[model samples]
Target: MNQEFKKYQAQTSPHPLGLEISHAKGSYIYDIENNAHLDFVAGVSATPLGHNHPKVIEAIKTQLNKYMHVMVYGEYVQKPAVELAKLLAENLPEPLEQTYLTNSGTEAIEGALKLAKRATGRSEIISAKNAYHGNTMGSMSVMGYEERKQAFRPLLPNVKFITFNNFEDLTNITTKTAAVILETIQGGAGFIFPQKNYLEAVRKRCNEVDALLILDEIQPGFGRTGKLFGFQHYNCIPDILVTGKALGGGMPIGAFTASKALMVLLQENPKLGHITTFGGHPVIAASALATLKEITETNLIYKTLEKEKLFRKLLVHPLIQEIRGKGLMLALIMENADITNQLILRCKDQCLILFWLLFEPKAVRITPPLTITVQEIEQGCQLILSVLNQIKS
Candidate 1:
């Protein structure tokens, strides 16, 4: 192990696919040994436009020459952040006109939860079983998996879990419920989608109970699902929508959107319900703005479905049981977690990087960049199938 990696870098797992990276461009990353590896993971689905996209990089340079962090919270009125918010307002659904930027997806979730409670004056929060919002304490409180969070017990109180695609459990979102937080696509849970009309029904139930609905679009936002936001695919709008991941192109950023009427609740009752030191740093916002521009202004958003079709068409193997999810946000279900593990490791060795979901061990994630070429898809799939043929059950 490298000295810095051994001493300073904390490992998320005892065994990591520790490949030292040199630089990346397009859909390829070069290691220190100059071995060019074809990227299929796209930095855990955060580089939807692929690595070092010229437009995104240019935006960062422009912003760097102008400004960086000006002040804390929403005090400075930075143009990149403000214009980015306005652009989101223009593209988003009705009443989702205002946005509060954050440093990461989990912070956006935290802000949404706080806003929901402040707006509804309710104490209970309802989330889905097998769902992942983030690793923060407030997010961990709602995580369905207990093994990873048991040691960090006594998180947020009054947090409840309901089945994701089951309308019957919607009764859990009662009048006392402050909010119902959910992933538009259950990312960590094998990219599991809500059954047809399930989201609409959930929206109706939330309205019936006067509980705010906070949809976590961290994974599937910014044209990952061939739509600006995954919630758009469901035809149901959330009271508060949290977005991140690819929102900053390759930069770390997050933002939650809501109606101005509802968002104002954060101002008066407590005056600054959520505050962060680097909430809307200008450079990050600039990259995000450029990413949004590329997705919306070009054909990148529409290309996702075509890329997804190519993936589905090529990823054929007897070991693969099912492919779940829409657009490019996808997963391949194997017979067991062991098989999934073997496949991921073998693919990495073969230069076709693959990863797994936090909650879905039997599934391997395949969320590539929207900019991934069709040839690249076929190439990666060929390598994947070859590995599957060579691997034993």
Candidate 2:
């Protein structure tokens, strides 16, 4: 099976850990050998409510019985898709009344970029340095890191990058800019939060230049940051809010939202400027509806602070240089990448799952499901401390 995976899997596989997962529930994933691994990474923060939550499973099954695929997106007004769109419109801030659903975050980013250019009739986009939006050409064009994107040379031109959280860089957003894209909280850059007044400053600058502010809430949305989205913590609203990952509760789904006025641009001036056949897959929409209901209807949204406090209190160690981020979206920065890798490997060897961030080599990720319990937190933390001590010597 491993050989087959390497042979026919398109050859993009990372250094596979080869764990062979069999099943998962709550905060634990079990291997085929029946060994349980306590999950701390939560599939890189994609499983917000945890693996196989009963409600989400029921929602998907219930929708499966009724229908699966009916027609091309935005044509028949499918039940699950319509209901999910309505729920999103009702929950978001004012003027964020229209949602265009897609298959993944990268597609949503592509659609949003097209919408911005169509709405403003401009060609330039500004993204933060070290930013990660997605992998599609349109999305990759704005990615901050050029090293990873170098092989795909000559990306969409007119895409510029600025230092994240730097007030002096606001001048770069001139009238030529159609949109300024940023992550509400930098995910691949090790869960970095916006400095004081940084987002507000960005908002103000965008307004001055008449450029739309696009917040990529893909990783930090869905109650991860103790609010409905990470931008809520910064007290600023984005013109275009892009989301994915946890939105579908383990199923694949992505969506971009804007005001009815802004979204209407995609419907005209070259009618159907952006289109996708599977944008609103019924089963995915149904699963997303269930996930949104769980996040919005329960106190699980506000309890993240207490959960984060518990983690911080118990995670003390001499080797831990700092703990960064808010709510359950956290990173523990160690002394160096070598130690970080050893600790992560040792933790998994001990049957406790931990992970590393993309850009921050010295950082370890701790973004579990919101349904994780206090007992589970203590257990995971204790295991982490033990691994840290072993690595320290």
Candidate 3:
């Protein structure tokens, strides 16, 4: 299976941590060899409720028996999709009432960008440097990292980059700007949180310039940040919000939400601004609806901060320079890239799962499933500390 994966599958990296999985439950993934690997990355923050969560799986099964994809979105008014959208609107702030669902986060981002341009009648879009939204053309164009995007030149035109949290850079957003998109919490840039009302200031500046503010909550949404969305921690409300990753529980989905008036632009003038055949498939929407219900009905979101505190208390070592971010979306910044790499590799061998940040090589990602228990947290932290001690000594 490993050889076949290497031979047939197109990979993103030359070296992939190819774990041949047999099954997964809750916070653990089992390999074909029957070794149970305790999951800490939660499928890179996609499996919010954990692998094959019973509630999400049951919802998918129930929907499968009734129907799957009846028709393209907005034509059929599927119950799951409607309920999910209505729930989202209820949870989100004002002006973010309607939703456009897509297959993935990048696609949702593409739709959001188009909506911004359509509503504002402007072409120039601004994003932060060291930000990771998604991998599609429009999202790639806004990506701050040049090394990864250099080969794919001539991306969407007029897209600009700004330093996140830099007050001076706020001057660049002007009347001509269509939208200013930013990750609520900078993910690939080592889980950097907004500094001192920076997001609120940006909201004010965009309002002054009459430009739309798009917040990409792809990695930090759905109770990952102790709140339903990371932007909730700060007081900044975006005009268009792009969401995915954990939105569908364990299923693949993404969505962009804006006011009904703004989203209607996608259906007017040009007509059919963006369309996906499988955007809001009924089964996926059912899974997402169950996931959202679980998050809201229970105290899972509130416990993320308590879990975060426990992790901080346990993961103290000299090799670790800092632990950045809030709630479950965290990164452990080691002194050097080599040390970080060694810790991650060693932990994998020890039957504990650990991962890395995209742009920051010296940082280790620790976005575990929100359902992880205190015992699991202690076990994972002990394994990590053991590896760090070996590297140091």
Please report the candidate that would top lDDT against the real structure. Answer: 3
State the local distance difference test value for candidate 1.
0.90
lDDT of each: 0.90, 0.90, 0.94
Cα lDDT of model 1 by residue, 1-393, tens digit:
466786799988887788988899999988898887888888998998899999999999999999888799788889999999999999998989999999999999999998988888888999988889999999999898888789999899999999988978987889889999999889998898878799999999999999988999999898888888888877799999999999989999999999999888888868887889998899999999999988999888888898888888888788999999888899999999999999999888877888999988899999888899988888899999889998854
Ranking by lDDT: 3, 2, 1
- What are the per-residue Cα lDDT tens digits for candidate 2 across 249-360? 9888899999999988887788888888888899999899999999999999888889999999999999899999888999999989998999889988889888888788
Q: Which candidate is the best by TM-score?
A: 3
**Model 3's TM-score against the true structure:** 0.99
| Off by more than 4 A, model 1 | none
Superposed by TM-score, candidate 3 places the C-alpha of residue 80 at a distance from the truth, in angstroms, of 0.7
Candidate 2: list runs displaced more than 4 Å: 11-14
Q: Which of the two, 2 or 3, has more TM-score?
A: 3
* Residue pair clashes in candidate 3: none
